[model samples]
Target: MASVFLLLVCVGTLLGSAGAQEAYDRLPSKFKLGVDMALEMRNSRAGVKRLLLYFKGLGQSDIQPGNDVTYIYHNFYMKATQCPKGTVDTSNCPFRNIKPEIDCAICYKTIAGKIQASPKPYINCIRKPALTEAMKRKRVNYCNEMGYSSGAPGGLADIGDTYF
Candidate 1:
């Protein structure tokens, strides 16, 4: 009976993970663009501290239509990393070992799909308390997959420098 129960638990875990992957795969590209824009906005405001953050995941999102523009609201997560603002290679940077933050923002894009730099999308991020042991353990699997990102897509353009 114990062995049977273990098998069922494993199977359930696999199914749950597969479902999550499928959902992510089906997410609209616009959702990803919103998340990317949110990340950029957050990094831009990371002033004197130079603290840089990486995308964690989206908690919630919604889109509203306007006359000739669309508002994409996003509530997402970002993990603080040891990498600073100018870090050229973030793939080697690990998390700061602290609790991640939840960022909320609303991005305005044109009907033609260009993000408006003017109305500067409203963005705010708040870091929670430190992570407990269990919370850290729960994120172990994400560590390996967290590699590859070397800061925002166009580099630190906020500082007036662009990488090729």
Candidate 2:
């Protein structure tokens, strides 16, 4: 009886841990072009910081320091567009729609491409303060041009506000 109780306890604990890990994995860990653009409009500084953290947390073998940003940018775009939407065929949508439910893929792709094309020579460029500042300015300008203001905090708040 003691051994059976111990086994059941261990099984329950393992199952709970697996469920928690799955929930975490379901959260966005890659920089999505549309999501980043929305966050930038809300708060450029926080947007870039979150993007940097996501990149840093990725598996080393998945992305290299010198990897082409354009490639990553493209991957993000593809992922956003490919994501299913309430049984709708979103692939035909002009803009890759994220939260707030709107089409704006053209703008997101253009800005993401430009950022990827820019030069970055500093070590761990994503972590460099100057680089982040520059990215913030660029993102802010892009958002402003599209008529979005810095009305809200970014990071988890932005995510919750937009999605939840």
Candidate 3:
């Protein structure tokens, strides 16, 4: 009986991880575009002193219908890239060694299927003390899969550290 229970637990864990991976895999192209839009929108309003941020981890995403319009929502992590505003390209930028902010946005698309920035997608970001272990892992995974480097020079270690 104990052996059967252990087996079930392991199977359950595997399934859960697989589901999480699938979440990242879904809407890959759209996801990248959405992140870019979110960044651009946020940067447009940020002051000169504010450091630009980039995608760190994905939290949740969904597509739903509202009042005859289709809206897509994304909850993700963004970390300071230590890059200047209007840098344009930050593909090789290193993450700043500081607390990451959680950014959530709700976006709508036009009939042409392009994410509309006007009606200006609702976005908000808050700095957290630290990201959870799961969130940190997600960040590393996201960077790796996207072909971007992960973490900062003196930031938390790749695997063991819980906060980043």
Candidate 4:
């Protein structure tokens, strides 16, 4: 639950997506043994303090008395993932059940390339689900543009593929 919460707060800040079409533009990558929360936050365009405050405010109520944090996180993840395809706002995302819908972009990030190592990095809002052959080709191109050699094996993925 802690891992999930931390991951959510940090990754959530990058949810302002522009779709995966241009992930090839930035094509950032990182390598490490495990999640380096601090380093990631430091590298974000959004100030780390801002994201911390934002997520902290959002997650405070998640830990309730006698209610396992793990359970809360699991439920959130499950319900959000099951949301209708193409949903931009997480109105039904269980993260919030109120009228004001939250952004689904929080969970939709695009990663283009075969991970050369652990702690794979991703481009912000550059990849989308390729529904056709052409889309898949775009993903391959994204990977190639990231400095991958011919047929070196790389592709596109989203935050959904990373987290939930």
Best by TM-score: 3
lDDT of candidate 1 over 1-164, digit per residue (tens): 99999999767655644443444356566666665566666666646244444444544333333454444444455655556766665444444545456544333333456656644444455554553445433332122112112111211112111110
Tens-place lDDT digits, model 2, residues 67-154: 2322121111111222233323322322222322222121221222333322221111222223444454443344323322222222
TM-scores for candidates 1 onward, in order = 0.46, 0.24, 0.47, 0.21
Best by lDDT: 3
Judge candidate 2 against the unseen true structure and give its global Cα lDDT, from 0 to 1. 0.29
Range of the 10 consecutive residues with the lowest summed lDDT in candidate 4: 69-78
Which residue segments of model 1 deviate by more than 4 Å? 1-29, 45-51, 64-69, 99-102, 117-120, 129-164
Q: TM-score-based ranking, best first?
A: 3, 1, 2, 4
Candidates in order have lDDT scores of 0.46, 0.29, 0.47, 0.25
Instruction: Please identify which of the two predictions, 3 or 4, would achieve the higher TM-score against the true structure.
Output: 3
Root-mean-square deviation (CA) per prediction? 15.5, 17.4, 17.3, 18.2
lDDT of 4: 0.25
Clashing residue pairs in candidate 1 are none
Question: For model 3, which pairs clash?
Answer: none
Worst 10 residues of 3 by lDDT: 147-156
List, residue by residue over 86-157, the lDDT tens digit for candidate 3: 775544344455645644433334223565554444455455654355654564344233222211221112
